[model samples]
Each structure stands twice: as structure tokens, then as C-alpha cells.
Target: MSSAIAQLLDGKALSQRIQTHLIQQIQQLEPQKGRPPGLAVLMVGDNPASAAYVRNKERACTNVGIASFGKHFPTKTTQAELEQTIQALNEDDRVDGILVQLPLPPHLDAVALLNQIHPDKDADGLHPVNMGRLLRGEPGLRSCTPAGVMWMLQEYGINPKGKHAVVVGRSILVGKPQSLMLLEANATVTIAHSQTADLAAITRTADILIPAVGRPGLITADMVKPGAAVIDVGMNRVTEPDGKSRLVGDVDYDSVQAIAGYLTPVPGGVGPMTVAMLLKNTIESYERRI
Candidate 1:
């Protein structure tokens, strides 16, 4: 085995490159479009983490010349109210994308509200229509996190064709879509979840391993194959022994880096890519209008 540290999949730099390109594209199209592309991010409650994420998204929109039509609702906001707002945004001619921030109030039904978003404007790509389109390999908006992972792979020339790709997690949000994308790229995909027996055995067999189960330190060094590409999609905040909090991914970065040929860092890896893909989806929706 080659004694070299795994190459980092630097998502932050790539995300910036994409945003810069998008800025130029928007500048060129604004004249004919008459207005900047608009994205409506509807956020509910005061969840600190969600608030921070919303702020980051809106800031990214501003940087890329996209108009932010964001709305902040109180914790007690009812489901009916949010649904009405989504309907209005759907009808709004200026808005090209609409995303409802997740982990909504306990009383609100997130799935029902997501279903109400018009398929074309579903920027998060969680609507059943988009998911269905993905399953059929048809052209449609895709879930941002999974799409970002695919882009990262392609950027580094890591083709999945004819490889054994093991994805740990079966959530509709990331795992399912990610597996489908890999399959589309001609990889033999295996999805392992919480109930999968001998998880390490399955993971060690992967040429490309992706863990999106949102648990920290779940994939240890022994679980990864030597020289295999490891992608960490999990984002978990854990407190260190020194009483400091930090973000970590599913794979043990230090250990995996030594074993795998390529690995993505937690905060700088999949997180930035996720936001970048969201912006890309919104831009695509805007272009479709023209």
C-alpha cells in the first residue's frame, strides 16, 4: 500500500468556484430576465442550528446575485399558514425556487407541507415528483446533498462505473438518492442500514464507501478498505474533552485518511457542497423559466 495521506475532497474551494461561475451567469442573464433569480426560503421556529443554516443560505444567495425572498415564522405558526405561503410563492412569477426549512414545529406536518410545493419550484428536491423522476433517471431537480456528493466524485475523476459502492443508511433524503445516483453511474450499489448484519464486513468490501447516517465516529479504520474512496455525509456536533464543541463526520477522519485513498472532511466537505447544489438547483429552475 502506498504510504500517503488520503487526498482531501475540498468542497469549500469547489463551492466557491461554482458560486463565482453562477454570479457571472446571473449577470449575463439578468438583462433578459428583467430581474435576478429569486429563491424563497421559508424557515419556521427558532431552532438555533436551523437559523444559522438559513442565514448561510440567504448570504450565499446574495453573493451569487440571487434575490432572497426569505420569510421567518414564529414557533407557533400553524401548518395551514405555512402551506398558504408556499402556495403563494408557487404562484409568484419572480420566484424560481421554494424551500421549507426542515425540523419544523412539533404540531406541523412536514411531509404534507413538502407535498404542497410545486414540483418545479421544489428547490430541496424532496417532493415525490422529483424523487420519482430520479428513480427513472429522468431530468429533474435532485436532492442537494446527494447531488453534491456526485459532483464531488466527478470533479475528482472518481468514476463509479463498475465498482462496488456501499452506502450506509437508507434515508430517503440522502442514502436512497445517493445509491440511485451511483447506480446511474453504473456502480454496483449496496445499501446498508441500522439493521444490516456485520456492517463492517459490508463496508470493507466497498470500492467506494459513503456513510450518511448522521452518527459520529461510526466508520472506523478497520471498516474501510485500503485505497478505497470514503465519503462522509454525516454532520454531527460533538463536544470534546476540553469542553469545546466541533463538527465531525460519520467516518473517523484521522484513521480513515490513513487507510483510504480519498476522504472528505466534515465541516468543509459535504456541508459546503450541499449549499452549492441548492443554489445550482435554483439557477436551473430560473433558466427553465426562460
Candidate 2:
């Protein structure tokens, strides 16, 4: 008897393709009398992880030929000052998209600060208006992660219509919007959270299983249905064998790979596609504004 491992979903390749498409689209656009499409990223505090994320985003912008405006504040900065900076970015004509890194200093209100970005310039797609548009089935910017997930499915030729999708987290940033995006693709969606009873039983019924719960090894082999498409969105840090920290996902890759028909890896999976989609959204916002 032979056992076959699941096919790996390559997010890095897909992200590069998406970026290439964006670069071409951007080059073909009419050059206006204003500056290039600009993405303004606001970072508060000096969290190493947050700083790395912001720096990666800026690099991605540069790679795609999009202009970037970055604002970094010390950990002790007041909420009022941050809001003022956001307000200025919101009013700047050269700025096409505004993104505020998550997990701001405890004193700052992330929701309120995100709300300050105009809907048209919300690159992260977390603004109230953008979320509302997603819920209402209206035309607007889709959340980067959700959009990237959809892009992967399409690139891999996985049709969600009439499929059962189980989303293992209900986070606003990943789970909720992701479930909705799958539903938009005509898939029956079930969103599970910490309170859900018998999560393993629920997950086993899915044709597409997505784990975004932020807990490593939460989804094991028995939990995933055979031939199911698995997407691991968690990026939890865990101690490695070398006594160092490493990033892993919610799904137990070794165990689940034996059962799943398709699987996305941790760091190399959904991570790269996110920035690519952000560039896509920035270009989309630019075209719309122009």
C-alpha cells in the first residue's frame, strides 16, 4: 500500500503572479498630474513582530513599484497624536491607501484608529465601511488575507460552489471575512470558535478546512476529512529543536498532510499572498480614484 501526501499550495508563486499582474496594470494606467499610488502604514510602539510586519509591507510596496509612506510612533505616544497623524494621511491626496499595523500600544484604540482611514484608502480592508460592504455584497476592497485565500483557491482550480467549508476561527481579521468570502463563492460556510462543541466532529465534515485560531497544532489528522483542502492561517511562535523560536500554523502539518488532498504550509503559505493582495488593492484603489 502506498500513502500519498497532500499537494502543497504555493502562496509565494501565486503572490508573485499577482504582483506581476499588478505591476503591468499599474504601468498601463494613465500617469496623472499627482504622485504615484501611495500606501501609508502607521506603526505604534516597537514590538519586534509588528516592526517586522511593517517593514515587510513597505518592501512589498517598493517591489511592486507603489509609493509608501510610513509613520512610526514610540510606545509612549498618545492616542490623540496617532489619530491626528491618521487624519493627515486620510486627507493627503497622494496617499491612496492607509494601513495601521495591529496590536497597537495598549493605550491606543485600534478600532477607532482604523475607523479614521477613509473607506477608499483603507488598504487593510478592516474599516467599518469595507466590512459593511463585504457583508452587504457590495463592491469595495476585500480584506487582504481573505482575498489572498480566494486567489489561492482559484489558482489551484478548487471550486467552492456546493462545497462545505469549516472556518476554525471567528476573528474579524481572518475567520469572519474568510467565511463570508467562501460563502460568496457559493460554499456552505460554518464558522467555529472557542465555544464551539465537538470542533473535531464539525471539521471532519468539511470539504475545505481552514484553521485560523492562532493555536499551533489545533487541527490534527483525525479532524480533517480525506481529500479536503486545508488552509493554515495561524502564525504562532513556538520553540524549535534548536532552542530557537519558529513560526508555525494552526494545523498539524505532519498529521494532516496524510489525510488532506491539498495543504498550505505555515510561513510560506498564506503569508506572502497577503502583501501581494495589499498591492493589488492599492492599485485597485488608485484606478478607482483616478
Name the top lDDT candidate.
1
User: Which pairs clash inside model 1?
Assistant: none
User: TM-score for all predictions?
Assistant: 0.98, 0.97
Candidate 1 ranges with C-alpha deviation above 4 Å: none
Q: Please give the lDDT score for candidate 1.
A: 0.95
Score candidate 2 by lDDT.
0.91
Off by over 4 Å in 2: none
Lowest summed lDDT across 10 adjacent residues in model 1 is found at 1-10
Residue 93 in candidate 2, Cα distance off native in Å: 0.8
Report clashes for each candidate as comma-separated counts: 0, 0
- In candidate 2, what are the lDDT values of residues 1-290, reduced to their tens digit? 12889999999888888888888787777366255788998888899998988998999888888899998889999989988998998898888899989998888889988888899999999988999999999999989998899999998999999999999999999999999899999999999999999999999999999889899999999898899999999999899898999999999999989999999998989999999988888888999988
